[model samples]
Target chain A: MKETWKELPIGCIIEEGGTSRKFKTGDWRSERAIFSKEKCTNCLLCYIYCPDDSIIMKNDKVVGIDYDFCKGCGICAKICKAKAIEMKPER
Target chain B: MPMKALTGNEAMAEAMRQINPDVVAAYPITPATEVVQLFANFVADGRVDTEFVAVESEHSALSACIGAAAAGGRVMTSTSSQGLALMHEMLYIAAALRLPIVICGINRSLSAPINIHCDHSDTMGSRESGWMHIFAEESQEAYDSIFQAIKIAERAYLPMIVSTDGFIISHCMQRIDMLEDKEVQDFIGECKPHHSLLLTDKPYTVGPLSLQDYYFEHKRQEIEAMMQVAPIIDEVGKEFGDKFGRHYGLFEEYKLDDADNIIMAAGSAAGTAKVAVDEARDKGIKAGLLRIRVMRPFPYKQIQKVLKDKMIISVLDRSDSMSTMGGPLFIETRAALYDTETHPPICDYIYGLGGREIDVENILSVFEKGEIYKKKGVEKKLAFIGVRE
Candidate 1:
């Protein structure tokens, strides 16, 4: 029920920017990242290193993990020096 | 119309001067060098208001042209042989982006031995580049096709390259009738890019990274656009003819009516075929020539209609596909006639590679073979002319 090839624009020009938000890459996660706020230093290293910007932030403080865009890359978990994030296999 | 003698490059340069596009970005190469050089002189003399960019390489020349075209400017350029080979990569980008950039190309042999005379190898090599190709027989046709090319490219939103045979047509002096500058300007009018980088207030990604998700869809759009070219070519050619007394079509049929034998060709080879047909007709033999003008959007339907009733036909190709079967034109022509109920036995005569001379004698021999093909049947489907062991 998606748009057919006939409905696409001429040339591969993406007319609207940020249309990438429509495709949720969370389905690509074989393993998911789990964040621990209690042991967190709140250094924002995970927030800075997360490729998908899935590290949730509320008023300059680390909140939780946003599963929608995260692909379980674990870059945020690896970059977290405070051991505030960990990757767990998905069911 | 004013009559004057000019070489193929001169004629094309004159057309470019009249079109006077917004930008002219080009690197000079043999045969096609005169075209851009003359245009540069036009620029120097202040004859036209165009941003002339003399790039270092043919690749850069086409790259600059693509950028200028994307920036909502009418762009033009010239190149031949290795220059065209170098621009091969950028050629597809221009057409895929739906940029209406017109290129004046002189057909020359590609290098290995580096023989630079005349052949269809340059344009034929780039056959799948997705650009509209209009092959002219002579200087007049080359000159006339240039104006039509600009209009066709802009109208169809596809880049178009009009070619003249190197040395044979490009250097040969011939009489051509010229349209007044005002008339040509009025005819083509202007170039209005469909989706331009500069003609927008909203931000739109021009050439985004298209992969598995939407690549096919985008390519399908380009294919659909090419499907729309045949009619536009007819309309533009007709309009040019109507206003200037010179008509155009997808392919020009010379003495095809009631002819038992037909010779299909393009470029300067077609020019020689005309004389061969005339000579054959004088001897009470029915010989005809079908000069293909448009190669891309290959006029299969139109060609099928004309070739349906012929007794036998031969496609004279200037470039060998090196596939061990036949030449490029030969393969395509045979494919086009696949479903015809009265299809004549089609054969191919691969000739004139590396600018070999295909004289009237060479063409007449092909016609002589057609008579035997009509009776006995075609044994040799492919033959090379003027090539030594």
Candidate 2:
């Protein structure tokens, strides 16, 4: 990006809020969270523990993880009681 | 225009009554307290619809003003001496945030001896706080500058400090040609903030943490905005003059044409110096006076033009800079004249500090010294006038 005052925002006033969603932090992750539907007990503990709200649910049933917004912090794997979620190194 | 005798503080309160800002968050300080007090009385009497917040301290007063201004409301406040000192940190924040908050700073001396008298030290100390500083010579100018300040502040999107010498002008009563409420309201119009916090449709953050990435750019933008102030002031002054028949400029030149020696000063002392200049003119000494109405943005080019032809000039500063060189106005005037082709011998005089009485004779003595300096070159760059030693 060109570093000049004209390129900068006027008065540094950010026009939008909650814009962090546009930045996919998943690129920063070395490992990604994988979900096993069969081994899952729909306790929603991982949903409550996920920092990035990456846990996905379908029809009120625990489905899989949304990696678009997830940073793969392994919080879901650490919080899962049924070991339904696993942390695997990204290929 | 209706004429009424009023003190400087009363005149400011009357202006507030006419403008009737949305929010006035202020604390009570000597000389300036009367301004807020009278406005508060107006608030009590239902004369104006304003949320008058009696803040705990000057810091909270300015903080509340910032919040109100950020929320897209017309905001104002008043302070003096130590009170202004207390609002120092928030002053920078308000200016950096670019909130058009109009502040009435009754100029008083800062502490150490703890004086409550008239001086320019209070506002002079905040020169670089990124606020436009306008000094008023009398109650009439003080009253009128408030209205002009509101328009200037809104147009420039920068904060403004309208100052009157404490007790000298603030407490002294004078006949002020007052404007009608309808005229003032129409002239000032409504407060249309550029970026308000209350704009839910376009959510934005104020006072955000920029760090090193964008802080410098934001400050650069602020400097660019400040550079527009001189022209904006001229435009607003002309509009005001056309409407009300009172013209203003960056500074006021009194009989400067064809004058050999000139005295440069600001605030109420300028009024006293003008009388001395007239006396000198009558005696054919060719003395003139230049009162700097606007201090910040310094008016470098305009001042250099006015002083370029003069042979001798003495800048009287009511406040000391403690810089060992000279006072604030002296330093600024010297710097302004540095690039000019005509090198007039300019001297600095530290005078009228701590509300010390400076009569016509005191000013006349300064002019006499300027004459002597013009003939036999200045031995000292700076001298103290009205001091015991």
Candidate 3:
């Protein structure tokens, strides 16, 4: 039955591009939110809700997101009043 | 237990609240702005804990939703007319990524002449974007299809569009019995992500352009996933009926079992046809109505089953195909029945363009004209309703 089910015409929509698969089960969360220096405020919302304390600041200005520990919840971007934080797929 | 008063826009918001989507990114547009506003109010009042992102433009609204869903969150967003046009690029990308996002597309006439009433032009233009399309007849179906869309899309890993006629359902208020919060949550909760971003350690890339060698395979896989959705939708619909006592199918038949003639339509026109069908039944005309809810994944099999022995099938599309031989939904319905051995004579009627009122008399006229073609045994011609040119 599964064989006939495979041959059944489910229409043409099912054939669209979806071959790109994620490498690791949790790799998407490891990437830390990065702030473009030309575009960030020292609001510290990222620091407060990194959920892992993955954000740190220095000299009264924004510093960096700790990729080693930052789970990319994107709450930082949601809470950013300046929209300074950007979540990028980690290398 | 049976009915509660709500507008189509309000029901859309209510459905979002019941599903408890993780995020809702929305911008306001005519006829559909109220849906977003209702959802925003639900978020503000703490009724739904979704992160309601009030974006600046429709593009950003849909982009933000794509970002959230790619991060493995159950996301929802909605727009209509120009807003839908603005998000055109993102709509295709969302479907390509298999984001499992659902959108409430309050259908409206597209611009240029700038009409704010009901039509399917906006939805029709996006028909090939790889999103499952579900049409709702009234506020209750609008409410129910929302829940069903999430389940189907998540399981199939495809996006869905739940559409309703703009002013017809969006502005009118009606009483609908809403599924209890606990019940709705249980039914839709099966869509819980297999490996969402909340859990750290897995890495995935979504929506990357591939070379010619790999492009076909990627598209093939998406089709496989979409094919899997047909059975899932059926199973979920049955399960929902068992739990909530409200039953819906891909094609909803009203008084069609013993009828030889049927008027087929979608969205609110199907509701309008129901009233007319009731009147026709009283006169012993054996007239009935077939309302299609789930338009994509086309429900070809279910349509074949319901329309087995009918003598004539009249399909009414609320939007024209412009210069095409038939209307958009009409083309699809005809295609579905074309290969079947037991299908009936089909007629295509294009009506209610740009929100012209479809009164009972108009419904009767369409049916009678279709019957005239049936009696003469000639192919039906494309029609225009209230079209004075």
| Cα lDDT tens digits for candidate 2, B31-126 | 799999999999999999999999899999999999999889999999999999999999989998889999988999999798899888899999
lDDT of 1 by residue, A1-91 (tens): 3767688777667776566777677988999998888988899988888888888899899999888889999898888888888999999
Give lDDT: candidate 3, residue B235.
82
Q: What's the DockQ for every one of the candidates?
A: 0.49, 0.39, 0.03
Worst 10 residues of 3 chain B by lDDT: B194-203
Docking class of predicted structure 1:
medium
User: How is the predicted docking of candidate 2 categorized under the CAPRI scheme?
Assistant: acceptable
**TM-score of predicted model 3?**
0.79
- 1 against 2, candidate with superior DockQ: 1
Off by over 4 Å in 2: A1-3, A7-9, A19-91
Between prediction 1 and prediction 3, the one with superior lDDT is 1
Where model 1 places Cα greater than 4 Å from the true spot, the runs are: A17-91
Choose 2 or 3, whichever is better by lDDT: 2
- The DockQ-based order of candidates, best leading, equals 1, 2, 3
**What is the TM-score of each predicted model, taking all chains together?**
0.88, 0.87, 0.79
C-alpha lDDT of all candidate models, in order: 0.90, 0.90, 0.79
